[model samples]
Structures are given as structure tokens and as C-alpha cells.
Target chain A: MKKIKVFTNGLIKENPVLVLVLGTCPTLAMSVSVINAIAMGLAATAVLICSNAVISLLRKVIPDTVRIPCYIVVIAGFVTLVQMLMEAYLPDLYDMLGVYLALIVVNCIILGRAEMFANKHNVFESALDGLGMGFGFTLALLLMATVREVLGNASFAGMSIGFLQDYKIPILTAPPGGFLVFGCMIALVAYLTRGKAPIKKSFDCEGCPSAAFCRKEGKACGTAETEAK
Target chain B: METYKLLLKIIMTSVLVNNYVLNKFLGICPFLGVSKKIDQASGMGAAVIFVMLLATAATWPIQTYLLEPNGMGYLQTIVFILVIAALVQFVEIVLKKFLPSLHGSLGVYLPLITTNCAVLGVTINNITDGYNFLQSMVSSLGCGLGFLLAMVIFAGVRERMEEADPPKAFKGIPITLVAASIVSMAFYGFGGFVTSLFGE
Candidate 1:
């Protein structure tokens, strides 16, 4: 039951892209297409699940001072493994994802999960959390990409919506378009989730025990993890 | 001559014609988050240029020699990201220990570069675009400067917008988005200029 809450939290409440706002770099770069978004999301999810499971299992053994670097090395190892498999099998998707794939090592989603959940939680719970967040991130990105690609490129998925029926807003597909879409989504989420979220001040609690607790301390606090290295 | 043309194309495309920030939206986090003031923007820009240039230089060798030759191409994402993070850490330490002034100004933005899509984007672009080491270096340099130029200009504009009267909804980020759109359109004008100079 508690694991279920953890899972659902990632889908909506602690969403990596929309709610938590973690991992914006890939959220913006690879979100050019729904397919890319889904592919990238799944790839990250696979890496996240494996990394989380491994980290959770090895959490006690890892030294304290070297925790962050250790997490990075573990995450990087999995990411490299994924990169090799993708190149061999999903070469097209690999090409499309470009550097954003390699950029996943620093993706706050994987590392954030490693630190916040996996390092502390049991393997089963960590895997569930990773799966949930991965899917949630994929969903958020798909939502964004749907709007961006359909409006920006006048297509849903790879197929064109049709010539007369489909109208591409060129701006929505461009750089400025990305900003606009991101802002609108953020505003929409804030509006939808308003009043439910408690607002608080101060966010330097780097040593805080509970992320969800600290996150609830402020509205923008958890979102700033999007910017966390 | 062919190599020279490719280099020139890369420089122009990355710097003006298809800028990573203004045109590609690769590094909007820093572009929006860190670009509050021109001076700081310039500093961030310089730091990004240095990092991007260095990252591309380093990744090229790793990709070509270590990954491709050894059949470890699958490790590109993992290796590249680890390299980038380590590189950022190395740069942070060097700046702190050697160039204190730069370290101070570039303090906050240094770690952020680890996740900067633009840095990773250029490194990946270098390989995808088939740029040899020299060409990738030049391209990264051009992209970095282009990013700096966009950030500084936008920062200046945003700084001025603080004093301007605007509606409440479109005041903060909405207005900024509109501003970015206009700026993007303005950048499109440079495309024509590049075409005229280089001849498509």
C-alpha cells in the first residue's frame, strides 16, 4: 500500500517533469517528437530501475563522503550499458536522441531517484519508485511533446494529422515555442494543483532527511530539484 | 579547401545561422535562469564557452578512440556524461584554486553546466555531424559564443523590462516568452545574411 503511494506520487504528485520539474534538459531537448519523448523516457526508466535496484541493494556498503560520486559512477555504468544496447538495436532512436541520451547520466531523474529513494529504500520499493517516475516523466513529456509536435509540426506521433485538418504552428516547434509550452504547462499545473500545495520559505536543507517533507515546505522548493546537479 | 568550407559552415551554422540557444533551445535553463544581468550573463557565457569547447574536445577522442575502436560505442551516453561531470568538477577546482575572480563570478553557474544540454548537445552534435576533432573544437567555440551572445542580449533586455510597464499576466515569464519569440524571429534574419555571404 505504501509502495503504491510512492508509485502514484511519481505519476502526478512527484512527477519528474511537471510536478518535481526534475530533468528539464532532456524534457526540452528530446521532446521534439512524441516517439522520441517516449523512447527517451523508457530508456531512462530502464536505467533508473536497474540503477535504483542496484543502489538500494548496495546503499549500506557505499561510503558516506563518496556517496554522490558513487551514485554517479553506478548510474553512468548503467547508462553506458543502455547506450550500447540502443546503438546495436534501436539505432534510429539512438540517432534521434543524440547527445540527450548521453546527457541522461546527469539526468536528475535517475540520480535524484538514486539519492532520494533508492539509497534509502529497499530494492523492491526503489524499483517501483523508478518505474513510476519513469512512466510519469514519459507521460509529462508526451503531454508536452504532443502539443509541441502537433501544434509545432502538425503531426501526432510520426504521422501527419493531414494537410487541411492539420495546421502546424511553426513557432511552437521552435526554441521560443518550447519556452512558451513549458511556461504554459507550469502555469496550468500550478493552477490545477493550487491550494492543495502548502507554501513555505527557505530551501538550504541539503542535509534534510525527507525530500517529500522538505518539498512540502514550499511550492517551488521541490521544483528547484529540476535544477539540482 | 573542402575541410575549410566545412569548418566555415560549422562556425556560421552554430554561431548565427542555427545557434544552440536562441535557435535550438538547447540551454534554456541557464538562458532563462542565469541571465538576469548582462555582466553575469557574460561571465556565464564565457564559462559555458570554455566548458563546451573543452567537453567537445575531450568527448571526441573518447568517442573515436575509446568507444568506437573498442566496440564500446554503447557506452557513449554513460561515458560522455561521466566525462562531462568530471570535467565540470575539474574546471570548478581549477577555477577555485587558480582564478579566484572567475571562480567567484562563475561560482553558481559552474555546477549547472554539468546538466547544460548545450554542452552535451555540442559534444553529440560533433560526432553526429561528422566533425573531426579540429572542426568540433571550432564548432563548440562558435556555439559557445553564440550562446553567450544570446544570453547577454536577452539579459540586457530583461533587465530593462524590469522598469517597463506591462500587464500582470504577461509581465514575468509570459512576456519573457513573447520576447524570446521576437528574438527568435530576429535571429531568422541572420539566416538570410549567412546565405548571402556563403551562397547556398
Candidate 2:
């Protein structure tokens, strides 16, 4: 049950995209289309799981002072692996993902998991957390892509929706639309959870890798109070 | 004179049209997370500008001279990131030892920059965009200036947003994101302006 809970933690409760809001760049950039979004999610997921498992296994071996860099080196290696395989076999998707696939090395989700969860947990649990978080990322992308591609483009996975074609909101496919849709999605989630979401701990600066040298009393990532008040 | 015009066009386009944060969706984390205070935002922006310029200068030579000749183009991602990570560390140490007052302000943001996607994005983008070394530097400068512009502008916006009270749910990041949506729409208007200014 505990292991299952670890696996299910990211599904909704700690959904990385919506709830925790870790990797917003990839979540926003890649979710314009269903296929690209899924491809991005899975690629990042593969990197996430492998990195998490490896980091957990090597947690004892890595020094405390340089752990973040070590985690990054590990994550980058896996990302490169994914990049090569995708380029060779899935060239089209490879082109579509572009710099984003490479940018996954800087993704907060992978680094955040390594810092917050994987380092302290066992290898099996860390991998499970990675899987759970990866799916959560994917599911959020699918949700946004459906809203965007269907409403914005009047298509589902590149297939035109005959009736909805005339009623599309084309702006949803543009860059601003990504921000608008994501803002609305996050608001919807916040409302549904009645602002009681389990986001307080992870909502702060911990998830960001730069927090390693943050001199701002753990508030380097700008808390809500600081931003609005 | 023609070369100067071309460089000016690249700067304008990157700063206004293809903005790193607003358009390209790179570096949204710092754009969103650190823009609350004008001072901090500018500090972060300055650090980003410095690192981005340095990263581009470092990576371009490595890509053109080292990787291209060796048939190791596939190693770009790994090599670039490691170089950036090391470069950031070196900058931090040097700044602290040689320039304490400057470090006092910018140093806080340096560590956070290592994983900031925008740094890597600019470096990789400079290469992929196929700008020669000098062009890459100009584009990166424009990218950094654009980022700084966005941060300073958004800091003012967030200050206004703080005065308005939204519902309970849209109070924090959600509302901030929605505000970003509106700001980005405004940025979209710059598209036509940049094209006309530079004659496309």
C-alpha cells in the first residue's frame, strides 16, 4: 500500500504540472499538439525514471556538496540517450521536440524529484515516484493539448474535426494561448481543490535547483505573499 | 553600415517579437518566480544576461572548432550543459572573490541560474539558429536584454496586480499566469512593429 501510494502520489494529488507546477516550460511549449505533447512527456519521463533510479542507487556514493551537479550529469546522459534513439527512429517527433528535448536537462521536475524525493528514498520507490510524476506530467499535457488542439485547431491528433473546424479559436494554438489555457487550467484545479491542495511544501523554492545557493531564506522562488502583497 | 542594420534587426526581433520568455516559452520559471520585486527581478535579469552572453561565447567555439571537426555533434547537449554548469560555477567564484559588492547583489541569483532553462536555451538556440559567432553574440545580447525588459515590465504589472483582490483560488500562481497571458497578448502586438521597424 505504501509503495502503491508512492506510485499514485503524482497522479493528481501532487500532479507536477498542475499542482506542483515544476516544468512549466515543457508543459507549455510541447502541449500545443497531442502527439508532440505525449512524445515530450514520455521522453522526459524516460529520463526522469532512469535518473531517479540511478540517483537513488548512488545516493550514498555521491557527496553532499556536489549532488546537484551529479544528478544533472546523470539526467543529461539519459536525455542524450533519448535524443539519439528518437533521432534515429522517430525523426519527425525528434524535429518537433527540438531544443526542448535537450532542455530537459534543466527541467525542474527531474531535478526536483532527485532533490526532494529520490535522494532520500530507495531505488524502487524513487523509480515509482518518477513514473507517477511522469504520468502526471503527461496527463496534464494531454488535458491541455485536448483543450488547445481541439478548440484552437479544431483537430485531434492532426485529424480535423469536421463540425468544429468552423468554430475554432485559432489563438489557442499560439504562444499566448498556451499561457491563457494553462492559467485557466491551474485556476480550475485550484478551485476544484478548494485551495486545500497539498502544495504548500513543494510550492516554495525547493523544487528549483538554484535553491542550492539561494541566500533568500528559502524564498528564492518568490512565494505568493511576496509576489502579490 | 548594412552589417550594422542587420545586427540591429536581430536585436529588435529577439527583444520584441521572439521574446525568450513571452514567445519562445523559455525561462518562464525565473520570469514568473522572480519578478515580484523590481530590484530582485533586475538582479536576476542582470545575472541571466551575463551568463547567457558568457555561455554563448564559450559554447560557439566549442561547437564549431571542437565538436564539428570530431564528428561528435551528437554530444552537443551533454557538452553544452556541462560547459554551462561549470561556467556558472566559475563565474560565481570569481565574482565573489574579485567583486564582493557586485556579488552581493547578483551572486544570490547565480546558483539559481545553472538550471534555469533560458541559459541553455540561448546557447543551443544560437547554434541552431546558424548565426556566425558575432551574430550569435548580438542575438544573445538581445535575448538577455529582452529578458531584462520582460522582467522589469512584469514587476510593475505584478505590483498593480497585488492591489486587486481576486477570488481565493486564483490568488497565487494561477492569477500570475493569467496576468502573464494578458501581457503576452500585448507582446504579440510588437510583432508588426518590429517587422516594420527593420523592414522585415
Candidate 3:
């Protein structure tokens, strides 16, 4: 039951992209098409699950001082594996993902999970956490992609929606559209969660994954409150 | 002259046309996080620029001489990230040791850049774009400068945004995102400048 919570927490309560706001780069960049969104999400999930389990297995062996580097190596190895498999089997999707696929090495959600959850949990629990977080990330991507693809390209997953084609919002397919859609989705999530969307109080080092290692970890660093005054 | 022109074009394209932050969405975390103040933004930007140049310089040779010849191209992601992580660490230690004053301002951001997609993005982009070592160096510098430009300008805007009373829902990141969208829209004007200039 508790393990279930660990898994389900990533679904909504702590959705990586929506709630945690970890992997926004790829979340915004690759959600232009539904198929790309799904492919990116699944690829990330494969890496997440594999890395989480591996990290969990080696959690004890990996020293605390070098854990971040270790986790990154592990995650990047899995990402390369995923990249190779994709290149060989799904060249089209592979091409579509492009640099973003490689950029998954730095996806905060994957690293955040490795640091926050996977390193501390058992293998089974870590795997479940990865699945849940991966699914949540995928769900958020799917939602954004659906809106973006339908409005931007007037298509769902490459299939043209006849009526919408005439009224497509070209901006929705661009960078600005990515930001707008992502912002609105964040707002929607916040509203649905009753303004409890883990809205970061500030953009300081506090929220940074490396905040623990920061020289000024405890004190206020980059808060708007401090800067505004 | 021809090679120099090509290098200049690559720099311009990376800086304006395909900005790592606004256009490519590479380093949104730091773009949004460190943009609260011009000083912090610039500090982060300098650190990013420093790290980006070093990472690309290191990775380009690794990819060309090490990975490509050995047919270990698939190891690009893992190897590049490790290189970046180590590079950032090296930078941090060097700064702390030799330039403690500079480190005092930028040290906090150095560790953060290890996981920053922009650094990794620039390196991978260099490989994918088929840029030679010198071209990759120039492009990485330009990308870093572009990120600095966005960060400094966005920081100025955000400084003003503090006074404006936004709505309840759009108070924090939502409004910032909206503002970023507008900024991104403004950057679109530069999208065609490269193509028109280079005839590509």
C-alpha cells in the first residue's frame, strides 16, 4: 500500500513536469506532436526505470560524496542504450527526437528522481517510482501535445483534423506557443490542485537539485522577495 | 575569409536564430531561476558561458578523435555528460582556488550547470551540426553569449514585474511564463536574418 503511494504520488500529487517542474526543457521542446510526445515520454520512461533500478541496486555502493556523478553516469548509460535502440528500430522517431533525445541526459526529472527517490528506495520501490514519475511526465506531455498538435498543426498524431486545419494557430507550434501552452497547463494544474501545485516560493538555490551542495544552501539566495526589496 | 565568414554565421545563428534558451528551450531552468536580478543573471550567464565553452572544447575532440574513430558514437550521451560534469567540477575547483572572488559570485551556479541541458545541448549540437573544433568553439561561445543576452534582458523585465500586480493565478511562474512567451515572440523576428544573410 505504501509502495503504491510512492508510485501514484508521481502520477498527480508530485507529477514531475507539472508539479515538481523538473524536466521542462524537453517537456516544452518535444510536445509539438502527439507521436513525438509519446515517443519522448516512453524513451524517458525506459531510461528512468532502468536507471532508477540500477541506482537503487548500487545505492549502497555509490558513496555519498560522488552520488550525483554516479547517478548521472548510470542515467546517461541508459539514455545511450535507449538512443541506440531507437536509432536502430525507429529511425523516424529517432530523427524526430534529435538532440532532445541526447539532452535527456540532463533532464532534471530523471536526475531529480535518482537523487530524491531512487537512491533511497529499494529496487522494487525505485522501479515503481520511476514508472509512476515516467507516466506522469508522459501524461503531462500528452496533454500539452494534444492541445499543441490539435491547435498548432490541426492534427492529433499526424492525422489531419479537417475543420481545425483551416483555423490552425501557427504560433502554437512555435517557441512562444510552447511557453504559453506550458504556462496555461501549469495554471490549470494549479487550479485543479486548489492552488497547491507546489508553486515554488522563489527561484533561489533552494529549489535547485544541487542546492544541498551549494555553499549558501541554507540562506535565501535568489528569491524574488529578497530581490524585489 | 570564407571560413571566418562561416564561423561568424554559426555564431550569429546560435546566438539569435536558434537561441539555446528562447528558441531551442535549452536552459529554461536557469533562465527562469536566475533571472530575478541582473547581477545574478549575469553571474549565472558568465558561469554558463565559461562552462559551455570548456565543455564544448572538451567534448568536440572527444567525439571526433575518440568516439567517432572507435565507433563508440552511441556513447556520446554518457561520455559528454561525464565530461561536462567533470568540467564543471574542475571549473568550480579552479575558481575557488585561483579566483576566489569570481568564485564567490558564480560558484553557486557552477554546480547547477552540470545538469543544465544547455551545456550538454551545445556540445551535442556541435557534433550533430558537424562543426569542426574551431567552429564548435565559436558556436558554443555564441550560444553562451546568447543565453547571457536573454538572461540579462529577462532579468530586467522581471525586476520590473515585481511591482506590477498580476492576478492571483498568474502571480509566480505562470506570469513569468507568459512574459517569456512574449519575449520568445519578439525573438522570432530574428529567425529569418541568418537564412537571408547566408542564402541557406
For residues B1-200, what per-residue lDDT tens digits would candidate 1 score against the true structure? 97787678778888887888777767765776666668767877987998998898899999998889888766666677678878887888898799887676664466667756788778888888887889989999999989998988888888887798754334454456566656766776786666677677
lDDT (tens digit, per residue) of candidate 2 on B46-68? 98999999999999999999999
Cα lDDT of model 2 by residue, A1-229, tens digit = 9999998888889999999898999989998999999999999899999999999999999998888778889999999999999999999999999999999999999999999999999999999999999999999999999999999999999999999988999889888899989988988898898868864422458687777655334555453233322
Docking class of 3: medium
Cα error, candidate 1, residue B34 (Å): 1.4
Q: Which 10 consecutive positions of candidate 1 chain A have the poorest summed lDDT?
A: A198-207
For residue A181, model 3's alpha carbon misses the true position, in angstroms, by 0.7
In model 3, the Cα lDDT at residue A54 comes to 99
Scanning candidate 1 chain B in windows of ten residues, the lowest lDDT window is B166-175
Best by lDDT: 2
Task: Name the lDDT of candidate 3.
Answer: 0.86
Clash count, one per candidate: 2, 1, 0
Candidate 1 overall lDDT versus native: 0.75
Which segments of model 3 are wrong by more than 4 Å?
Answer: A204-207, A215-229
lDDT of 1 at B82: 70
Clashing pairs in 2: A210-B112
